[model samples]
Target: MDSSTHKLYHEHDFDSRQFLENYFSDKPDMVFGDDSLTFLIENFRHVFTVGHINGDILIDLSIGSFVHHLYSACEFFKNIIVLKVNNRCIMELKRWVDDRTGAFYWGHTSTILQEKEENSDQFEDQNAKLRSAIQHIVKYDLEKENMTDPLVLPLADCVLSAWLLDVISKDQDDYIRYFRKFSRLLKPGGHVILIGVLNITYFTVGKDKFQGFPYDEDFVRKALAGEGFIIDYCKVQERTAVSDLIDYKAVIFIAAHKEK
Candidate 1:
C-alpha cells in the first residue's frame, strides 16, 4: 500500500448514496446481495428472533446509511438510536426515516426479512415499523469521550454495530479500543451484536478505496472477552461474492452480552 497513491480513511470524501448503490442496491451491477445483504439480514433475524436478544433501546453505530440490518431489530426493540460518524450517512438515514422524496428504496431488504420469517406482512408495513422505531439519528465523533457529545444518551439494552470497526480502525489495537467504546454503551447484562468482514485490506466506495484492518475470529473473541463480554452466538459466512469492490474473505456475526 503506497502512501502516495492510496488515500487515508479520513481523506476520502465518502458518498453515502454511492456507497449504497455500489454494494447494497438490488441492481444487476450490485454483487453483494448474497454475501452482505442477505447474509447480514438473515443472521440478524436469527439472533433477534430465536437468540432472544430483545430489549427496549438498541443503539446502532454502523459504517454506512444502511437500514436493512435494522428490519429484524425493529420488531424486537422499541426504540432504535442511530449514531453515525459521517454527516452524509446521517442525512441519508434521516431522508429515509422522514420518507422524503428520492430516498433510497429498501423494499427488497424488507422482502428478504419477510421471507426468512415466513411472514406475509407487506414490505411497506415493515418499512413503516422501521421508520417509527428509529427514534434518533445523531452525528458522533469517535475521538470524543462522549461520542454523542452533549446528548448524554441512555445506556442501551443492546448495542448493534455493523462493518464499523474494521473500516475506522488503523490497527488491531484501535479495533479493540473502539470495541471497548461500544461495550460501554451497553448496560450490565445487555447484549452487543457485531457484524464485520474478515481478512480484508480495503473496501471501495465509488472510485476511492478506504483501508481496512484484517483480523481473524480468534482475535475478535479475545477482544470481546477482554472487554468482559460473554459470547453467546457466532456465525461466519465465507465470501461468495467475487468483486473487486472489497477484498473481505468472509462475513462474521457475533452476539455477545456484557458480564453482569
Candidate 2:
C-alpha cells in the first residue's frame, strides 16, 4: 500500500471537515432547510449515513459537515450506522456517532485523488485522463479480491448512501458494479437514497486529500438505471459550499428504490 498517499488522503479529509463546518455554519438553511435533505427525510424510512452520522447512517464517500446536518435532521432516528473504509473517516464518523447505537466498517480507496492529480498536470487532457483514471480505480479497488463482496447486512427497509458514489470509484462501470453490490446488501424491494457531488474536485480533511469523481445529472440517472433502481424522486440542488478551502459546484440528491 502507498503509505504516503494514504496519509495525504487522511490529512485531506481532516482539513475538509473543518472547512465544511465553517462553511455550513455560515449557511445553516442551505443545508438543513434544503430540498435534498428534505427529500431524504421524507423518503427513506431507515437511513444509513455511510461514513458517519449524528443519528443515522450517513454513508457518503466524501468528507463534509453534511454528516452533522444529517444527525441534526434525523435526531428522531437515534439509531444510526456509519461505515467508512478510511481510518480517518471512520474515526470522524465514530466521534459523531458517539454513544449512539451504530456500526462501523473499514473500506477506504484512493483512486480518485491519484487520477485527479495525474490529470491536473495535463489541462487539455484532464477530463479524459480523469475519467480513465476513475475507471481504473473502480475496477482495481472495488472489484479486486481484497475488497468486500456481497456485503451482507441486516435487513433494512431502506438504505442511504450519500456522497458515496462520487468518491468510492472512478470508473462509471465500476461505480455501477459497486451500486449493484450495494443493492444486493438491501432486502428485496428496499429503497436507497443517494446524494452525489456534481463536478467537484479535490477536498481536504486536515492535511489529507479526498478526491471527488465528477458527475452530472445524466451520469447519475444512467448509473442508477443500470443498477435496477428507478428514481422515485430526484432533484438538483445548488451546491452549498461545504468548504471554502476546496472547489466544488453542486450536490445532487436522489431517492430511488430497488425494483421488487
Candidate 2, 1-260: lDDT as tens digits: 22234333322334434544433333443342333344333333233333221322222333332442232223323333344445544544444344234322111111222232334343343223322222111111344443333442344445566666666655677568767766654667666767766775555444555665666789889988877888877767665544444455766767777788
Q: State the C-alpha lDDT per candidate.
A: 0.88, 0.47
lDDT of 2 at 168: 60
Task: Predict model 1's lDDT versus the native.
Answer: 0.88
Q: TM-scores for all candidates?
A: 0.96, 0.58
Candidate 2's C-alpha lDDT? Answer: 0.47
Model 2, stretches more than 4 Å misplaced? 1-66, 69-79, 99-152, 240-244
Q: How many clashing pairs per prediction, in order? A: 0, 33
Alpha carbon deviation, residue 153, candidate 2 (Å): 2.2
